[model samples]
Target: KFCNETSDEVDRREHPNKHFICSFADCKATFSKLWKLEAHYSRHTGLKPFACGDCEKSFCTRYQLTRHHLSHSGEKPYLCSVSGCSDAFSTPGSLRNHAAHVHHQKENSYVCNHQGCGKEFRKKKQLKFHICEHTNELPFECDFEGCNDKFASSKALKRHWKMHKGYPCDEEYCNFKGKTWSEYQKHKKTAHRVTLPCDQCKKMFHNAWFLQKHKQSVHSGERRMFKCIREGCEKSYTTNFNLQNHILVFHEGKHDFACPFAGCGKAFAMEESLKRHFVVHKPQKTKLQVNLCDGCSMCFLIHYILEMLL
Candidate 1:
């Protein structure tokens, strides 16, 4: 009675030898062949039939699939394991190529012996190209009679020959002597006098550097040098560099270091610089408001005799 019950259970679970059920829940999808079942499962799961074991990427094509697996296995079966070369590959064909082209260093490998040229190639076709430099053998000649320069390749010759014909030059002071009209136009616009006019005044310089310097010196009214006597503050500098150094050394602080000065909520590179800057916040009697230009003004906490130069 126990054997009959076991047989009935097996019959209920098993398919008719050909039919296969989908693994997904509630969906009673069946296939006659195992391959059909796999294909059907792929549609539901978006699974790739072929996979590369090396990089762990999957592909549909067998060739890509095979290549992908090689990356993971480090199985460059093809290799050029010659002396002086530690290169490894996943395939035999690639290895054989490395040995023949790079490592083997064949006897018949012709090279260009030109003074400045150092090109070595295995094929004679490449060697022929190298020989052209020494012989000055211009197979391609420019059509322009005055511009009789020859080139190794017909394409280069064509480009050079185009230079002989007149082209449009757009530069303010540049002469139109380019091989093509478009090149002349580009040179005129880019290399010539295309510039940004300053919004402030009539004074103009070639670039923005002169303009920035003019703003800093002419517009910045007072040069307030706040020098601190803290142990870290060494040579006084123009900008924040000296101040940052002071904080780092005396205060044991970093560039992003916390301010060790009690009740100060600022982080500084140097402690001395921070202390010197904090002095400005304290109540002081002698304060001077120096006006540089009509548009610029700065406040200083020190006073000196203003000498009228004009």
Candidate 2:
């Protein structure tokens, strides 16, 4: 049982499996065992117990720590026993994955069948995930109420969950559990004694990346800016990516990638969107079931609709 704001026994042992639930306000993740619950809870507490001796890197799981150690050791236990060349890998998956990119060009049939986008893969799973980029289908979604956030990968969704379920500050007096990764990193530096202590304010940072960003954004006077030097525009950006985006979206209004349908100037910011829009232009061979949004009467693919509705 996990203790929380409500001080509840957040576990139930059923016939099939034991369910250990997280007691966080928005987090409703349930695990089969107490240890799994503890591990999951650490994600919200920013507690990375597993540390690498060679570097300042730390991980929540020992498996991740083991994987990190492999980078320093340069040990690839798994090797491809197939044909002409000898190739080694740290994991079994890597050996198989690299074969598609490097050697074993004949056997693997896992190739992208998308028109003009013929990329080869070692496994069907890789190809399937890659297909989502063209499809623009985000499978992972936040389960939090009132949040309709979606992600292409489960890992991305898990990372994004930091906003919904933040790691609590180690400092007893501090009640700051940040709403984002950057916020939490900064909060850990400023509030907790996890990172190197700041000389001026006596704050701590877990990593150097956060410390540098904090200095640049908060402490340092020499701020990096990508300023839009327009006639009347006073808009400035921190990164060049944002500056380019501002120029393209508002300044230039360049519709480089637009819908192929005649008289439709529906512009897209990304090329991936242009690829997905091609599906709309193509005549459907099989009748794809779609649902219409009640609010806007916009049609959506059935699977996508089901994913959203569920």
> Which number leads on TM-score?
2
Q: How well does candidate 1 score on lDDT at residue 184?
A: 66
lDDT of 2 by residue, 1-310 (tens): 4345232332343323645678887665777776677677676665666766654455766777888787656588887877776878787667766877787445556889889999998788778888988898989989998899888778678888877777776566877777766777677656564545655555566545445444544566564566787778888865444555577778788657778789777887544346556666664853565555453223445555333321
Clashes of 2: 3
Please provide TM-scores, in order, for all candidate models, with all chains considered together: 0.26, 0.33
Judged by whole-model lDDT over C-alpha atoms, candidate 2 comes out at 0.65
Which portions of model 2 miss their true places by more than 4 Å? 1-20, 23-26, 32-39, 104-310
Residue 77 CA displacement from its true place in model 2, Å: 1.3
| Model 2 poorest ten-residue lDDT run | 7-16
Across 156-199, the per-residue lDDT of candidate 1 in tens digits comes to 76567566655645335657576666666566556774354445
For model 1, the stretches where C-alpha displacement exceeds 4 angstroms are 1-110, 113-128, 134-137, 144-149, 154-159, 165-167, 171-197, 208-310
